[model samples]
Target: MRAVLLTMAALAALGLTGAVAVVALGLYNVSAVAGHLPGVSWVLHTTFRNSVWLRAPSEEEVPELDDAELIALGAGHYATACVPCHGAPGQEASATMQAMVPEPPQIEEAVAHWEANELFWIVENGIKMTGMPGWPAEGRDDEVWAVVAYLVSVQGEVAPELELQTGGSEPEEYCASCHGEVGGQVPRLDLLSAEYLEAQLQAYRSGKRPSGIMAQAVTSVPEERLSELATHFAETADEAGDAPVASAELVVKGEALAREGTRDVPTCLACHGEREDGRRKGPVLDGQRRGFLEVQLTLWRDGVYAYDPLMHAAARDLSNEDIEALAAYFARR
Candidate 1:
């Protein structure tokens, strides 16, 4: 028994020594152009598959992917951030993309292999060794879900029902790609003051605000053009369909909260351009989408927008019901 144990220990030591020699001697190829060793590709690919499957969200956690607005938002982002490397329906990966060590897969071909949850895992967390990057913003799984929706719907082809513009020459057009036409949760940009819009854009650019979608949107936009886009959108009526409908009761509940403050917080009107206080610098909330308002308020409540300590403190004590009422109230306006 002792002799067998000694033999096993000697073999383990030899294996460790061999691994160290390989690294210290630079015996392995590190270049992208150089091919992976025998069995290496299989090991990596299998591990990636298993890792994604293990970490993907459960069925209950995944949101329904059938919403047109959700698909459109994802498609617009896909055009901006994904098309160059992953390729759309008709487009092939660029030569530069093809030259990557493992090479990126065409979404059309690749997305079919994985389930929606697996795709979400890959989109949010990214893979270990491949050049694919995780979603740019932390704690923004909503943005990642949007991308997954696109991948699932695209299904190896682009369909006309997807009204996304693939490329834009001007900054306004680029801004419109995500914020125009198909509005469900996206805000009514036309209602916001130009100053507020510009400040938000600047926050996105400076990383004070975190949005995977907005980060990608702003990268192509020149700093000077951010003000221009914001001003133009603020002045122009967006084709975001009609005003969303809310029940009279919900609106009434929302209004009372907005006009009157609870003991824990100030009136919503004080900061949302209804009053002349210093907090009035905040965005004009009237006519914004109810869903968008709810999301923003929730983000503030969760302390995700900690850059503004005042706003953070103000929203921290809000209940979900309070948030819903406030969003409904301002949206009806």
Candidate 2:
């Protein structure tokens, strides 16, 4: 028995020594063209599948993936960041992406193999040895969920109609893809001053605002065109802005909160309301969508957006109900 144990220990030490030699001497092929050897592909794929299955978010933690706005937001991100590798419906993966070892699979069919939570896990935390990157911004699972929402739709094989589908590579076209329609999920650009819009674009460009989606989108836009893009959106809000979804009671409650100052919380309109000067820096909230407003307000209040000290102070004490009412009121206005 002792001799058998000794033989086992000797074999283990030999295996360890061989592994170290292989790594130190760089004996293994790392070239993409060479690809993984025989069973190596199976081992890597199995590991990834099990890792995602083990770490995926619970059903309770996963948000509703059927929301239209959520899916649209995801599609916008996919267009800019992912369309290159994952190609949209009827689009084939480019030669460069196909050249990659174990190349990126077209997610439409691939998505059906995984649950939403597993998809969320794979997106939020990228796979090892694969080119897939984790969600660009940290602590923004909401944005990650947007990608999951879109992927879920693709899994169903029904490519969603993207906000009328503005198709182009120009800066204005990209911005209009999500912001073109008034009373849409994103804020109403027409209601905001050019100065405010320009500044926000500059902020997005300079990384003062940390949105993974916006960061990638604005990076492609030329520096000089920031103002041009802002002006275009601000002036061209031809579509009228109105409440696509808001109860009368909710709006009334929101209006009262906006008009009257609570002892601890200032009125919403104190700073956001019309200023004496025709030109101002404060963003106009009058016609912004309730969903968009709620997200921005929550981000400001929770310190997720730490750049604006004043907004942090203003939004500090707002409860979920307060945010909902304020959002409803702004949408109605």
Candidate 3:
């Protein structure tokens, strides 16, 4: 027993000495340009893969990802949030990004190796020591899943080029990329009141709303152009017709919820419904896309929209079913 104890003590002392030596002598290479040794690289990558696999949710846990609308929404977000780092269909990543150690891989090549859930996990909670960042919009799991849906659909295909309206100012051109495009995930701006649209744009620009995508988009636009962009969109007619079919039962449930408030929750109509004085505290939710409504409600519930405490309070008691119903109800209008 004494001999065994002595041997264990000597091994511990040796490990401590090696650790102290590495720190004191600066034996470890910390330079990004130098890159990792082959063995070290192998270990990090293997650990990363296994960690993602283990932590990822099962296929059943993820909502149906085959929806065309969902994939379209994902594509718009990808163009804004991801294109710089990973590149898209025919585009190549920037030269500086290519030089990053453990450089970001093209989505086509990388998605092949990961399952849908694994992709979701990586996108929602970014990998450390790699340049990949998690979704910038807080509590936006729906958006993350949308990106995953896009990845699944785009594996063997190049992304289609979305048309932006031309003959507009540069700021309007930027707005057209997402809002003007038909069948996009974002709400149809044409159906919204100009005042509401302008307010939201101002909120995004001022950081009152927490959307990395919108915040960055508005940065390039002059403050004066915000109203012009809003007017252009508001005057444009909504060509897209009818919300996608949802469960009739779900829609019915949603209608009841929207029309009548429970003991704790207020009627959604009180703020969103028509007012006699022509005042609206909330954006018009009627006829908006279901996915966008769901995401925004979730954001409100999660306290991401700090500007509207009433919205946060209203959304606080909402169950997932309640949210789905509300979105379905408003979407059909």
Best candidate according to TM-score: 1
Q: Alpha carbon lDDT of residue 314, candidate 2?
A: 81
So what's the TM-score on candidate 1? 0.89
Candidates arranged by TM-score, highest first? 1, 2, 3
Choose 1 or 3, whichever is better by TM-score.
1
| Per-residue lDDT of model 3, residues 20-120, tens digit only | 99999999888888999879888999999999999999988888877766676677667666777787765667787778888888767778788889999
Q: Cα deviation in Å at residue 85, candidate 1? A: 1.4
Please provide, for model 2 over 238-307, each residue's C-alpha lDDT reduced to its tens digit, 9 standing for 90 to 100.
Answer: 4634436778888898898778776665566877887677543467787777877888888888888889
Which one wins by TM-score: 2 or 3? 2
Error of 1 at 169 (Å): 1.2
What residue runs in model 1 are displaced by over 4 Å at the alpha carbon?
1-9, 156-168, 276-279, 319-321
Of candidate 1, the 10-residue stretch with the lowest lDDT total is: 158-167
Compared with the true structure, the alpha-carbon lDDT of candidate 2 equals 0.79
Which RMSD values do the candidates have, in order? 2.8, 3.2, 3.9
- Candidate 2 clashing pairs, residues 3+ apart or interchain: none
TM-score for each candidate, following the candidate numbering: 0.89, 0.86, 0.80
Clashing pairs in 1: none
* Winner on TM-score (1 vs 2): 1
